[model samples]
Target: MSTGPGADSAPAPTTHDSRSTPEKTPPPGTRAKSSMFSSLKVRNYRLFFAGQVVSNIGTWMQRIAQDWLVLSLTGSATAVGVTTALQFLPMLLFGLYGGVLVDRLPKRRTLLVTQTSMAVTGVALALLTLSGHVEVWHVYVAAFAVGLATVVDNPARQSFVSEMVGPDQLQNAVSLNSANFQSARLVGPAVAGLMITGVGTGWAFLFNGLSFVAPIAGLLLMRARELHVVQRAPRGKGQLREGLQYVAGRPDLIWPIVLVGFIGTFGFNFPVYLSAFADDVFHAGAGSYSLFNTLMAVGSLVGALLAARRGTARMRVLIAAAVAFGLVELVAAAAPSLWLFALLMAPIGMFGMTVNVTANTSIQMGTDPAMRGRVMALYMMVFLGGSPVGAPIAGWITDAYGVRAGLAVGGAVSAAAAVTIGLFLARVGGLRLSVGWRHGHPTVRFVPRERREELTAAA
Candidate 1:
């Protein structure tokens, strides 16, 4: 079943006649069957993709600057946690409302407003930091503003992809989006670190502020005539509750969200941990800290590319990736030297991106199209909103137990969550995990004992 981007609306499914299937293969040398990158065929998506790449770099720069600014001011791990919490707390509080707004409005216009707001906020932060009169309060205010914008921006941005590429290219577009983000992660912090060393955090903010121009321009330049507008529903009472109900009814949706919340809340509060490790454990400077993040992004970029190559998005892969990601984090926490820890970050990032891309792709593919905005919004809440709760806990742990212990605790919790969820899914799906060969390749498959018996009988 399909649905539009609001409550109480469903779309008719397009029919495919099995009897009409063609047996003939396509001619060779005719593009050799386009891969996932085919989404770039759309002019609007190309513009949007290009703009987001530039904007994401700036966003990452601001993130680094904000973390550094908070640490410099308070000199407390908990303070950095507080800042992170403030930045993401709004998503926890108002994300559902934000989803509703996205459904009710034209996404292109909404994004324009959000991008403008964020630019203003970045400029405000830059001015404060540059004047030498900025205080912790100013940073808090700016962070809150950014978070507020995110509450609206995230859902719109996510839902907008389908409108750009259409449902046929949704998975490819999503994977590419992950690639875009991780790519920015690779560049942004490294640039911010150099900027911080040469000028100050303020300039990073200014650069980020200027980066908004690319996206704003992209949004303005989008030929609305080219958009594949999803039919939208009129707003109504209990829309938020209705969205919640739709998600609650689908295990495919709920389980991934639950898993993401567990991992995000327990495992993904890296900003706090990275800062603590940099200052307390390694006694390193900001450049080394940025280097650590850049290495992780290297891993993440590879993971994204790998995900893009996959033929299908499967639940088993998501669960396995989550488990692997947790294990990598556990190992990373125990590294004895800064160089060792930095090296360990590669797999940690790779697996983290694996989980992120898999979960995101599965949720988007599985959700009802009408409710896509709300579902993705909830996904974002779990994926990002958990930061508010997790950051402070990680911060406090870093302060109380030392950075290594704090990181170790997070890793342990993440591993435990992955194991628990994997077990639950196996039981519910009546699946037993096994490694085997398929299509002349090594593969993993989950099968019920009865299904195995039936298959053998049929053979």
Candidate 2:
């Protein structure tokens, strides 16, 4: 079903790298301990997770501080969007090639290089801001630099999960990773708000720069022999084209990527929307912005925990979450009061996290290990790279019409895409819509066409 030698189009048998050394099974006695946090039993994964906990908090802090700084300096939402666009533009332009490089390189060493490069950019920005000589352009440059690093870092980190935890725990491990990120999101913004108000954005930037030490140390501490080694793709021409063709032939992989590309490009422009809402619509300033983000983090953390507990990634869940996420954003756009608006951020975040985690895990689980880096790069590219295309447009709409109009437009586009893609997938999968009352409840679902006919005959 795929162009690559052993690419998988389905979930069940696609978890491990067919070309790699035998996967490391969980330690004896731990096999029966399958639970939400089962992946934590792996020593390498545990260290990686702990290091990310610290680093991710710093990441969130930097994000909040950076957006606020840009908004403060320009007083234009468009400029803030431009900053975001610059940061992700490289991903859009060069992500595919980055994936190829990731396939060939040692994931750990590649991450070290990328992480250090990003740290340098953060420190440079911190110095510029602290010295009181920072310009909007300097922030732009730093953001772009980080983007370059992310081109390689994102795909490498994603593919590395299998190496650390193996296929048995991949789903659980991916979910926990999201949970860890959301947990950091909960703390980082609140702290960034205080720092932005009390000290300054520079300190937040500095903190982010220095936070790399933990992850670097963790990487150094990992036992090399324990890793489940997936063979690196040999350098050869048309490898990029090979990865593309592999995905093209897999309906499961291509459809999800297309769905997320639309959502990410249009629906995920929160930096623009939130800042404008806090400043223009609500007049509450940075504190309210941070509060909105924190509440959203609360919902995201809940969603991630639930996903970890579920221990599976289903396409149905992904589609439902995407629809819910879009609808929530539409509701939030018209919120009449600050508190109401803030309260709505939770569901938006929850559904958004659900869509994100489901797509990520499903794609990883379905892909050939040898081709994972490229596939993930395409996934991340569409998911994150769309920001460059979406952010500026969102900002312009906010400036021209209003935050409500801009947000509603984005939500509408997202919802439409979800419904369209859901139906298309259902049809292609040979399922028919089944909507009616079953027992005491209303049921709306898709079933095999033959099942639908059988049900009709029985009725």
Candidate 3:
């Protein structure tokens, strides 16, 4: 996912590193606990989680501020998209390499470097903008710089959770991570909006720059003794190729990445969508733009909490959530009034978060820990990396046709991709779709193809 400014694809084997997997058991004397907050019990994860909550709010704030600043300067939606694209372009070019880099280094140290670099980018922007010397090109350069840092930060962070919480808490921890981000989303945009309106965008950037301090402190504070470190991938010439080949062999892993490519490329360019709607369609200005994001965060927070309650991430959930996400966006695109559009943003946020959390948790829980950094890099590359391609296209469409056309195109592509991938996976896995009402509610089920045939014959 882009890690907003928002937001994985893949089914993967439920395995650990080449070394023996954690036994789905708790450490030492602690009993297995599966609460939504189970992962927080670990002192390391609690610290990490707390720091991330602070950092994520700052992230979202900067995202909103950055986009608004571009729009204010250029008054061009395409320019805004250009800024977003620049921010994610490096992830497309170097994200997999970053995974290789993470597999070779100490994750804690790697994160500190990436975090510090990003802070510098934020601070530089703050300095330029606050001094009243900032320009569109400066924002572009800083956005690209941040993207360069994220190439390492993203994969390192994804694979680090296991060390902090172990296999037993991996799924819950990932869900809570999404939840924590959404909670931050709820605050970040509203705060940024106010800061941009009442003060200026520079303050938001400055606060974001400072927020990096929290994660660095948390990393320093963690006890090395308690970490459940996974074996690092051995340094070798073929390591990157090896990781790619490993994923190619695993259907559970590769298909999800493919599906996400389509969705992320077309479906998830909300910075473009929301901004165009707020500025062009609604003519409501920064406050309206912020409100749209806040409403979506409200839905996203609800979705993340729901995801945290579930013990497992199923393929069924990913497909359903994605389908719902696309459909809701379609509905939202057609909303006639600003209030109705804002009202519809909630479900769009909910289903979008579900698609994100379900895919991320499923990928993390199902992959080999040794291969995780690489696999997650691919997952994120597909998710955030697509912004480079999609953001501009969305911007162009909005510029040429309208905001509604851009959104509808994205929604249609997303929904179509979900259906296509869902069926292809079923055929590959020897399952068939079974749709019927089990009680009062409509339901969709996947069963063995033979069983599906038998039931059809009996019917």
Candidate 4:
């Protein structure tokens, strides 16, 4: 790949160069340094990135405030779970249709509408809280509205990244996006906690409501001249079914989606567990709750940065990370003290990000440009849609078994899922697992030794 002033001006190279090239031309499979932050070189992406950073910080703040508010009002773990479920239920019900809409519409326009809708929802919630008349049912209604917007917003946003950076730098752009989200996660909760303690939760919601202006402004400011536009498919019959078939045919896409569904449904429902840990297990207040999330975000930031440094997405990395994530959660559940539980959060965040970044990068890289929106919609369904099913179950478990046992159940389910899926892939892919460290980096060779011996015996 060549990196130069005209990098975006000139069309992407049609064929790989075979001869030894100059330093400016990176070797095949090796990305240029410029590619690490290449999307920023595009004016549109720069605006989008900046806008999302501000908006995402507020989004995180609102999440913490909302959870805290629910707990304060009801003092029920199951209530918190119900709120979360109400918020995500829309995605579970209508996410596929939302994806089809994204495919049929202009992503920028879709985002503008969704962002505005979300801002309105936030403002309403803040107003209700400020009036001191907020009720649990009011929160429930608002949560559902936010979730409805999310079902549309998520697919539009995921597909929008490819248009911003083009295919050449898609992996880098996606990794950086994850990094931005984690960075916000690190800052948002701590800030929200302080703001809530010093002022009120209403103010946190107000801040979130105002934050949408940045992204809206960024959307308005985008230089449409620079976008690498994908041709929209004509409205046709069975579009949703087509997307499903397309993904079902590819094991690489299918298995990861399955894995994420299991992880999201069984292991990643943090609201229920976090609330229980804060109120019941540690007897800590909101500050400690925010601190726990901040620590997890710190580890997530590290994971995202490491992912950004990589040039390619590999399937084995996804599998290993999923297994590691599950095990870490198990350890966290078993911790004897608050500090130990917080400590385990770091590895949990790290491996969780690894699974997410790897799966996201792979799905984007592998999909056809025309089908990107729909494919990503299906991906979101597996990712976020699972939360509705998982949150209530997690909450009930936390209510029944105590927080520790609830968390342990989630971890055990996630671990079993990873091992089962990983082994199934090995068999289907004809892989044997062997381990060694190459240049100090651990490596697993997937082709089985016995399979190799059998082939040799036949020969």
Candidate 5:
């Protein structure tokens, strides 16, 4: 679940060329160049990447600052949880309608308004903090306002990728987008910690507010005539229901959404987990907290780059990543020392990101363009909107049982969901998990049911 400080789980670079391209683009299943930065070759996408890099770093800074700010004011982990809940509560309530809005409106125009609103919210918070009038209520209202803006921004940005780079680089562009966020993840937290310690949280918020300028400028500078715009959904009745019905009829779309709901609700409550661990379990200050985030960012950056290099996202990859994410989190939870736990954050971040990039890319590739915004809204809603419900539970667990148990619960649920879905998909898809020796090496593979008889006869 990408949090407010940054749109952490937003789309990364991936390319899927639509048939409407001037040239005949390859089929949806065709592989792309494995270069991690391949999508940047397009001038429009390049501008978007550059602008987003700056904006995302600022976003991360705000996220780190926002969480710390709340913790400092209240001194209760539960209160911190409440702030996270407040930030995402609007997403739970209005995210679907935002999707409907995105589909009906021009994506670029919609993004412009949403980004500007978010910038205003950031500046308002900074002013409040700097003026010494910032209270718990101000923070709450700012969080909610940001959430409300995100309801539209999230889907608009996801569907906007196609317009920038077209379908050919869809997967690569999307993966790069994640890498961009992860890259920001590395820089933002370290800088935020220093700012928080050296100056105050106000400066970080101020920096984030101004950073929105880059994206606004970039959007204005784009050559509108060159954009590979998709067909917009017309004004019509039952649009929201139609979007839901479309997904409901497709197993490929619906299952991933369901899986993300469980994982997002339980596992992606990291801000709550990390903050509590820093403040309570480790007794480490903001600096130590920043270090943990930086290390995880390192892993996430690596994972996103690797995903970009792979050039394809499959259901199998998503399942494997989810399982690994859970196992790594569990291992991290059991680490006895702060340093060991910190080191484990790398793999945990890597696998967590793998699941993230995989699921997002798959959904986009499998979906219809006209319905893209609405479908992505549902995806974002499941992945992020659940934070309102999950954060409080995680906070309560962290406050009561200790950070370890809270983390373990998230890990267990994440792993269980991945395993359950994987096995069920295998059964329905007419595949069996086969274990055997290939030459001298033992191997496990998923074999099609029709191929089992031939393999048995040969053996």
Candidate 6:
């Protein structure tokens, strides 16, 4: 693959050249050097990364401020939950349609519009809050509007990665993106807290509103000719159904998504679990809850970095990560001490992120570029949409039984789903369990059925 900024400008050579230029030639130990940050070598992806760093921090700030503002306004936690629900409601209702639109439109242009809309919502909210005329309804309206924009923005941004860095760097880019988000997550809340107490929420909102300029400018500055543009899907009816059918037909595509659906619905309820564990189980209060979140964020950041370093996404890795994520949660649910439970949050975060990044990269790598938008839309829809349905069940379990039972049930469901899906995938792929010694160590893993006789004879 070409690494230079001008590589896209030249036509490909018909044959291999022994005399490649130094600029295009990779170093002797290129793998070690490039593993963690190979995607940033692309000029376009670098711009996107830089822009997102600024924008994402601002976004996290807004999220903290928004929830806090809603709580203050109504003095009701239920109202705060309602506001959170409104932000995600649009995606649950219309996410697939948004995907169809993304496939039909130019990704960069679509993102510009969506980002602008989100910025407008932020600025409007800031003005209202600053003027002392803000109402709960106005905050609700802004949240919904931002959600509406995200419906289009999420898929567009996801698909656009391929354009910026091409297929070779897709997995690394995606992993880095997660790292970027988690990094912002670590910093944004602290900043928001400072702004809220020292100044007010209005400045945080204003900062978020203006952060859109970074991404918008990045979009404008990107070189159009360098992007690896996919052919846009033509305007047509039944496109949503077509996307669904495409996923349904491919076992490789469908099964991972199904696994994610179950896990996402049941396993990813960290807020409820963490808070309950903090207050009810340990009686450690809000400081402990915040500490738990920070540790998890650190683990998530580590997980993303590891994924990027690995530079490949495999189904087995995804399944193993899913299993580990579940088992870790189960162990943490029964942790005897507050410190032990808090420490376990790190591994839980790491495994959860591994599952996320691995599944995302595998799905994208396997998908047709033309169907990329819709497929990602479905993937995100299942992942994000499941939260609403799952959160209430989790809450009910916590309220009725206890936090431990609620968490244990979720972990059991996730681990069971991973095992079932892993076996099914192995079967479909014509593989069987192989148990033996490899080199010196004992080994047990799935292997191709055709290799069974060869392995037995060798043994």
Top candidate (lDDT): 6
- Candidate 4, 1-459: lDDT as tens digits: 122232123333333211112112224346445345666787888999999999999999999899889999999977887888888889888988888888777777789899999999999999999999999888889899999999889989998888887766666788889989988887898799999999999999999999999999888777665777555555777888887888888786788899999999989988678878988989998777777777888888878777777755777778888888988888889888989988888888888888888888788777765566778888888898777778889988888888888888888888888888888888887777766567989976676668667755766
The 0-to-1 C-alpha lDDT of every candidate, in the order given, reads: 0.80, 0.86, 0.83, 0.81, 0.83, 0.87
Give lDDT tens digits, candidate 5, residues 3-51.
1221212232244322222223345457666688888888877878888
**Candidate 6 local distance difference test against the native:** 0.87
RMSD of 1: 6.6
TM-score computed on alpha carbons, candidate 1: 0.82
Clashes of each: 2, 0, 4, 3, 28, 0
TM-score of each: 0.82, 0.84, 0.83, 0.82, 0.86, 0.93
Residue pairs with clashing backbones, model 6: none
> How many Å off is the CA of 35 in candidate 1?
3.0
Model 1 misplaced regions, further than 4 Å: 1-36, 67-83, 125-136, 196-202, 272-288, 334-339, 395-408, 434-444, 448-450, 455-459
lDDT of 3 by residue, 212-268 (tens): 999888877777667775666666677788789888987767877787788889998
- lDDT tens per residue, model 6, 354-376: 99998888887777766778999
Model 6 RMSD in angstroms: 6.1
Shift of residue 201 alpha carbon in model 2, Å = 5.2
**lDDT of model 6 at position 185:** 97
Q: Residue 420 lDDT in model 1?
A: 84
Better of 5 and 6 by lDDT: 6
The residue pairs that clash in candidate 4, if any, are 432-446, 432-447, 432-448
Cα lDDT for residue 105, candidate 4: 74
The local distance difference test score of model 5 is 0.83
Compute the lDDT of residue 101 as modeled in candidate 6.
91
